[model samples]
Target: MAYKTEHITQQIRAAREAKNMSQRELSARSGLTQSHISQIERGTMEPGLSSLVDVARALDLEIVLAPKKLMPAIGNILGSASVTSDTLTSEQRKLVGRLERWLAGVRDQFSIASEADTLKDSLALLRHLPLSADELDRLREATLHLNRWQDDPPSRKELSEFAHAVRQLRNATVHRDRDGAVPRSAYALEEEDDDA
Candidate 1:
């Protein structure tokens, strides 16, 4: 089956609301156009992987993809059990803690992984997050922003700007290259400057 864009979009929208964010705030955070966010939330657009990451970052959420079976097993045995947030059983809390740790590891690993591998791993990880329809909408918007980045590589100055925008959405530290910067290729810059 094709990837479920609508489902994911909905989740983004929901998450944003849960965090009490407005569309404009989300747009500013994710570097996405407000209109595009609206379209995705309305189920009129499907976003790519990079956008999803941006949205997830904006919401202080992380994405992970493990085997589908493994997630349900963990959720059922841990999250859905008699384990309220305030009253987590030792085992239940431990499982959630492990998942969080694993997710952190995955994020760290992505810094060194090939871009293609990073994208794939990100998509998989995203599937494991407790996404709702609204959060998915925000994710779609963020994905659109990333698409723009891929289409046109920014200049070093532009990349610095882009990175700053990403930092806003991510609300967390991002890994930089060995030089403490994310590089933008010339071709990528050309692409970004060209008007579609």
Candidate 2:
């Protein structure tokens, strides 16, 4: 939690370089001067929390504080653990983690999840789902339209169709996951072997 400014600077520099962005571009996007950005990257300037936040936002990175033991490392750090011995299988746990991360990436903290948000979120969520090329393209086109219509609300029919398509995608995803899941009999056989 108490990282040296040098470590922070290294992370910032790495993120910028990984994106192949110049310091000037980072400065422009983050609203910091190029000299200041360079100084931060060189570890000559210590950035405040807010400035680091701006840089992080510009680079699409987040700074998370977790306990060293890392219990919060699993699932949502602030939310209830979705994994339980009696409920979620390991596969289900993994899928849930992926979905949560996708949703988190779709929206910043404290943002509302509108219908448009849901469609955008589905694009990332469907990576884990078994979707045909046409289905994927349809979702992508719909999401693009929703994103473009932020200034102008989409038509009633368009919204209805997009929502229905998202529902269909989600239903297909659940069924695909279910079909791919190991049958309970497989677990029962394993239990019997353990007893034997």
Candidate 3:
């Protein structure tokens, strides 16, 4: 594979993993088989434009065409990009902060357990998962539950249960395979004849 192809595939792979999405999940969303995704990520097969667009859309990414002269400006903008759609919303970030504070207060009262660590891990994942209104409400409810315990901290077992509940909530928000008509390809791979 050429360096450019390798670089592009690496970006796709990194983006997929950063979103905590498996290639199988991406395959379902992109309407490509898992093997196809694997090959693309490995740079063994050159990706068609339609295939690349599908994969990028599945990852909530947009592909734009720009003049070559603007490459430096575009690169600079991307390099300094912040809080893209893939990241948690501001409200979600605030809730996570509150949860962290609650956790800190709980730790002061009781010896931290593995469940606390689990809760932390779950919170970390919340940052990466796509935020929807319903998910936000669920997260808010979790924060409310934590706040309730702040005044009267729950027992170790109760805390463990709470951690499990949060983990389940996060898992519920994670994307799953869906059945539907996949998006049509935007381009055809076969070369067109100039004299038709």
All candidates' TM-scores? Answer: 0.40, 0.38, 0.47
Compute the lDDT for candidate 2.
0.57
The TM-score measured for candidate 1 stands at 0.40
Best by TM-score: 3
Deviation in Å, model 2, residue 115 alpha carbon: 22
Model 1 accuracy (lDDT, Cα): 0.50
Candidate 1 residue-wise lDDT at 148: 61
lDDT of 2 by residue, 1-196 (tens): 3347778789789879978999999999999999999988877777998999999999987777754433312222112222224333444434445434443443443223465466555544444444444445555554565346666755556565655576666545433323334212212223335321
On residues 1-196, what C-alpha lDDT tens digit does candidate 1 reach at each position? 3348776787789888878999899999999888878877787777778888888788887667756424423333323222334432344334334434433434333333353244444333333333334334544454454446556643445434433443332221111122224422222223344321
Candidate 3: where is the Cα deviation over 4 Å? 1-83, 108-112, 175-196
Residue range 1-196, candidate 3, lDDT tens digits: 5755677779899999999999999999999999999999988899988999999999998778876544433443353243365455788888978887777667544345677777787787676555557778988888888657758768777777778888776555542211112222212233352221
In order, what lDDT does every prediction score?
Answer: 0.50, 0.57, 0.71
Q: What lDDT score is found at residue 72 in candidate 1?
A: 28
TM value for model 2: 0.38
Residue 132 lDDT in model 3? 59
